[model samples]
Target: MTSDCLFCRIVAGEIPATVVHETDATLAFRDIAPKAPVHVLVVPKAHYADVAELAKADPALAGQVLAAGAAVADAEGLTQDGFRVIFNAGEHGGQEVFHVHAHVLGGRPLGPMVSS
Candidate 1:
Protein backbone atom coordinates (compact mmCIF):
# COMPACT_ATOMS: atom_id res chain seq x y z
CA MET A 1 0.00 0.00 0.00
CA THR A 2 1.18 3.53 -0.69
CA SER A 3 2.02 5.32 2.54
CA ASP A 4 0.25 8.52 1.59
CA CYS A 5 -2.53 7.21 -0.59
CA LEU A 6 -5.91 7.92 1.06
CA PHE A 7 -7.68 5.00 -0.62
CA CYS A 8 -4.98 2.60 0.52
CA ARG A 9 -5.43 3.86 4.06
CA ILE A 10 -9.18 3.41 3.75
CA VAL A 11 -8.73 -0.15 2.42
CA ALA A 12 -6.32 -0.99 5.25
CA GLY A 13 -8.87 0.32 7.79
CA GLU A 14 -6.59 3.10 8.90
CA ILE A 15 -9.15 5.61 7.62
CA PRO A 16 -12.92 5.38 7.67
CA ALA A 17 -15.02 5.05 4.52
CA THR A 18 -18.58 4.20 3.60
CA VAL A 19 -17.86 1.12 1.53
CA VAL A 20 -20.57 -0.01 -0.87
CA HIS A 21 -18.95 -3.22 -2.15
CA GLU A 22 -15.77 -5.18 -1.73
CA THR A 23 -14.22 -8.38 -3.07
CA ASP A 24 -10.81 -10.01 -3.04
CA ALA A 25 -9.54 -7.72 -5.78
CA THR A 26 -11.61 -4.54 -5.57
CA LEU A 27 -13.31 -2.08 -3.25
CA ALA A 28 -16.14 0.37 -3.94
CA PHE A 29 -16.55 3.43 -1.75
CA ARG A 30 -18.22 6.82 -1.88
CA ASP A 31 -16.09 9.65 -3.10
CA ILE A 32 -15.16 12.23 -0.48
CA ALA A 33 -15.68 15.01 -2.99
CA PRO A 34 -18.43 13.67 -5.17
CA LYS A 35 -19.07 15.49 -8.42
CA ALA A 36 -22.41 13.84 -9.10
CA PRO A 37 -25.44 12.69 -7.15
CA VAL A 38 -24.26 9.10 -6.99
CA HIS A 39 -20.50 9.20 -7.19
CA VAL A 40 -18.68 6.04 -6.26
CA LEU A 41 -15.09 5.12 -6.85
CA VAL A 42 -14.26 1.47 -7.40
CA VAL A 43 -10.62 0.67 -7.01
CA PRO A 44 -8.41 -2.38 -7.09
CA LYS A 45 -6.85 -3.52 -3.83
CA ALA A 46 -3.39 -3.72 -5.30
CA HIS A 47 -1.58 -0.41 -5.71
CA TYR A 48 -1.17 0.77 -9.27
CA ALA A 49 -0.20 4.37 -10.00
CA ASP A 50 -2.84 4.85 -12.69
CA VAL A 51 -4.69 3.10 -15.50
CA ALA A 52 -1.58 3.27 -17.65
CA GLU A 53 0.36 1.46 -14.94
CA LEU A 54 -2.40 -1.08 -14.42
CA ALA A 55 -2.75 -1.71 -18.15
CA LYS A 56 0.95 -2.51 -18.39
CA ALA A 57 0.93 -5.00 -15.51
CA ASP A 58 -2.16 -7.22 -15.74
CA PRO A 59 -4.78 -6.97 -18.47
CA ALA A 60 -7.04 -9.22 -16.37
CA LEU A 61 -6.89 -6.76 -13.53
CA ALA A 62 -8.21 -4.08 -15.84
CA GLY A 63 -11.19 -6.29 -16.70
CA GLN A 64 -11.78 -7.00 -13.04
CA VAL A 65 -11.89 -3.28 -12.27
CA LEU A 66 -14.35 -2.63 -15.10
CA ALA A 67 -16.49 -5.58 -13.98
CA ALA A 68 -16.52 -4.27 -10.45
CA GLY A 69 -17.53 -0.85 -11.72
CA ALA A 70 -20.40 -2.37 -13.69
CA ALA A 71 -21.55 -4.30 -10.62
CA VAL A 72 -21.56 -1.07 -8.61
CA ALA A 73 -23.50 0.76 -11.29
CA ASP A 74 -26.09 -2.00 -11.27
CA ALA A 75 -26.32 -2.05 -7.52
CA GLU A 76 -26.76 1.72 -7.50
CA GLY A 77 -29.73 1.25 -9.87
CA LEU A 78 -28.31 2.98 -12.95
CA THR A 79 -28.37 0.13 -15.47
CA GLN A 80 -31.56 0.99 -17.37
CA ASP A 81 -31.38 4.75 -17.53
CA GLY A 82 -27.55 4.49 -17.74
CA PHE A 83 -24.48 5.76 -15.96
CA ARG A 84 -21.01 7.07 -16.64
CA VAL A 85 -17.84 5.16 -15.85
CA ILE A 86 -14.60 7.10 -16.03
CA PHE A 87 -10.91 6.57 -15.37
CA ASN A 88 -8.50 9.48 -15.30
CA ALA A 89 -5.31 8.03 -16.76
CA GLY A 90 -2.76 10.72 -15.99
CA GLU A 91 -2.21 14.35 -15.00
CA HIS A 92 -3.66 15.57 -18.27
CA GLY A 93 -6.74 13.45 -17.52
CA GLY A 94 -7.09 14.86 -13.96
CA GLN A 95 -6.01 11.73 -12.14
CA GLU A 96 -5.42 13.12 -8.67
CA VAL A 97 -5.83 9.90 -6.72
CA PHE A 98 -2.87 8.19 -8.41
CA HIS A 99 -4.26 4.73 -7.63
CA VAL A 100 -6.46 3.25 -10.31
CA HIS A 101 -10.15 4.00 -9.74
CA ALA A 102 -13.31 3.81 -11.81
CA HIS A 103 -15.74 6.60 -11.05
CA VAL A 104 -19.38 5.45 -11.16
CA LEU A 105 -21.61 8.46 -11.69
CA GLY A 106 -25.38 8.51 -12.20
CA GLY A 107 -28.78 9.09 -10.53
CA ARG A 108 -29.50 12.33 -12.35
CA PRO A 109 -29.39 13.99 -15.73
CA LEU A 110 -25.80 13.03 -16.43
CA GLY A 111 -25.57 15.16 -19.56
CA PRO A 112 -22.07 15.17 -21.04
CA MET A 113 -19.40 13.97 -18.64
CA VAL A 114 -15.78 15.07 -18.51
CA SER A 115 -14.86 11.82 -20.21
CA SER A 116 -16.25 8.38 -21.06
Candidate 2:
Protein backbone atom coordinates (compact mmCIF):
# COMPACT_ATOMS: atom_id res chain seq x y z
CA MET A 1 0.00 0.00 0.00
CA THR A 2 1.22 3.47 -0.82
CA SER A 3 1.83 5.57 2.29
CA ASP A 4 0.33 8.67 0.70
CA CYS A 5 -2.82 7.13 -0.69
CA LEU A 6 -5.95 7.67 1.40
CA PHE A 7 -7.67 4.52 0.15
CA CYS A 8 -4.49 2.59 0.71
CA ARG A 9 -4.41 3.77 4.29
CA ILE A 10 -8.00 2.69 4.74
CA VAL A 11 -7.16 -0.68 3.23
CA ALA A 12 -4.15 -1.02 5.46
CA GLY A 13 -6.27 -0.27 8.54
CA GLU A 14 -4.11 2.78 9.17
CA ILE A 15 -7.26 4.89 8.88
CA PRO A 16 -10.82 4.22 9.94
CA ALA A 17 -13.63 3.97 7.41
CA THR A 18 -17.26 2.87 7.42
CA VAL A 19 -16.49 -0.31 5.52
CA VAL A 20 -19.61 -2.15 4.33
CA HIS A 21 -18.23 -4.98 2.20
CA GLU A 22 -14.88 -6.61 1.64
CA THR A 23 -13.52 -9.21 -0.76
CA ASP A 24 -10.18 -10.84 -1.42
CA ALA A 25 -9.21 -8.03 -3.77
CA THR A 26 -11.56 -5.17 -2.93
CA LEU A 27 -13.07 -2.99 -0.24
CA ALA A 28 -16.37 -1.09 -0.08
CA PHE A 29 -17.02 1.78 2.25
CA ARG A 30 -19.45 4.64 2.78
CA ASP A 31 -18.50 7.90 1.16
CA ILE A 32 -17.90 10.70 3.64
CA ALA A 33 -19.22 13.25 1.15
CA PRO A 34 -22.19 11.27 -0.09
CA LYS A 35 -24.16 12.28 -3.15
CA ALA A 36 -26.86 9.63 -2.70
CA PRO A 37 -28.54 8.10 0.33
CA VAL A 38 -26.73 4.86 -0.37
CA HIS A 39 -23.38 6.13 -1.62
CA VAL A 40 -20.42 3.82 -1.36
CA LEU A 41 -16.97 3.59 -2.85
CA VAL A 42 -15.71 0.20 -3.99
CA VAL A 43 -11.95 0.08 -4.34
CA PRO A 44 -9.21 -2.43 -4.90
CA LYS A 45 -7.10 -3.05 -1.83
CA ALA A 46 -3.97 -2.77 -3.96
CA HIS A 47 -3.40 0.80 -5.10
CA TYR A 48 -3.58 1.82 -8.72
CA ALA A 49 -3.44 5.43 -9.90
CA ASP A 50 -6.62 5.05 -11.95
CA VAL A 51 -8.93 2.57 -13.59
CA ALA A 52 -6.95 2.40 -16.81
CA GLU A 53 -3.83 1.63 -14.91
CA LEU A 54 -5.60 -0.93 -12.76
CA ALA A 55 -7.18 -2.55 -15.78
CA LYS A 56 -3.83 -2.72 -17.53
CA ALA A 57 -1.96 -3.95 -14.49
CA ASP A 58 -4.41 -6.59 -13.33
CA PRO A 59 -7.52 -7.16 -15.37
CA ALA A 60 -8.79 -9.81 -12.99
CA LEU A 61 -8.48 -7.45 -10.04
CA ALA A 62 -10.27 -4.77 -12.00
CA GLY A 63 -13.12 -7.20 -12.54
CA GLN A 64 -13.11 -7.88 -8.82
CA VAL A 65 -13.56 -4.18 -8.19
CA LEU A 66 -16.61 -4.14 -10.39
CA ALA A 67 -17.99 -7.21 -8.70
CA ALA A 68 -17.36 -5.67 -5.30
CA GLY A 69 -19.25 -2.52 -6.32
CA ALA A 70 -22.21 -4.61 -7.44
CA ALA A 71 -21.99 -6.57 -4.22
CA VAL A 72 -22.10 -3.30 -2.31
CA ALA A 73 -25.22 -2.32 -4.22
CA ASP A 74 -26.80 -5.63 -3.27
CA ALA A 75 -25.85 -5.22 0.39
CA GLU A 76 -27.21 -1.69 0.41
CA GLY A 77 -30.59 -2.92 -0.93
CA LEU A 78 -30.20 -0.99 -4.17
CA THR A 79 -30.01 -3.94 -6.51
CA GLN A 80 -33.80 -4.39 -6.94
CA ASP A 81 -34.31 -0.70 -7.62
CA GLY A 82 -31.06 -0.28 -9.54
CA PHE A 83 -27.90 1.69 -8.84
CA ARG A 84 -25.16 3.54 -10.67
CA VAL A 85 -21.50 2.65 -10.66
CA ILE A 86 -19.12 5.37 -11.80
CA PHE A 87 -15.40 5.50 -12.44
CA ASN A 88 -14.12 8.98 -12.93
CA ALA A 89 -10.72 8.80 -14.59
CA GLY A 90 -8.37 11.74 -14.18
CA GLU A 91 -8.43 15.33 -12.92
CA HIS A 92 -10.83 16.43 -15.65
CA GLY A 93 -12.94 13.33 -14.97
CA GLY A 94 -13.54 14.45 -11.34
CA GLN A 95 -11.25 11.96 -9.68
CA GLU A 96 -9.94 13.60 -6.54
CA VAL A 97 -8.30 10.56 -5.07
CA PHE A 98 -5.52 9.12 -7.21
CA HIS A 99 -6.35 5.57 -6.27
CA VAL A 100 -8.86 3.76 -8.49
CA HIS A 101 -12.38 3.35 -7.08
CA ALA A 102 -15.98 3.02 -8.23
CA HIS A 103 -18.76 5.13 -6.75
CA VAL A 104 -21.90 3.09 -6.16
CA LEU A 105 -24.85 5.45 -5.91
CA GLY A 106 -28.51 4.69 -5.29
CA GLY A 107 -31.52 5.04 -2.93
CA ARG A 108 -33.03 7.72 -5.18
CA PRO A 109 -33.32 8.68 -8.79
CA LEU A 110 -30.04 10.12 -10.02
CA GLY A 111 -29.52 13.05 -12.32
CA PRO A 112 -28.40 12.60 -15.89
CA MET A 113 -24.80 11.53 -16.45
CA VAL A 114 -24.20 14.88 -18.10
CA SER A 115 -26.14 18.13 -17.85
CA SER A 116 -26.42 20.41 -20.80
Best by TM-score: 2
Q: Estimated TM-score per prediction?
A: 0.94, 0.95
Clashing pairs in 2: none
Q: What is the lDDT of residue 111 in candidate 1?
A: 81
**Candidate number achieving the greatest lDDT relative to the actual structure:** 2
User: In candidate 1, residue 82 scores what lDDT?
Assistant: 90
Identify the runs in model 2 with alpha carbons over 4 angstroms from their true place. Answer: 114-116
Q: Residues 1-116, candidate 1, lDDT per residue (tens digit)? A: 99899889888989999899898999999998888888999999999989889889988998999999999999999999899999988889888888999999998877875433
Relative to the true structure, candidate 2 reaches a TM of 0.95
- lDDT scores in order: 0.89, 0.92
RMSD each, Å: 2.0, 1.9
Looking at candidate 1, what is the lDDT of residue 14?
96
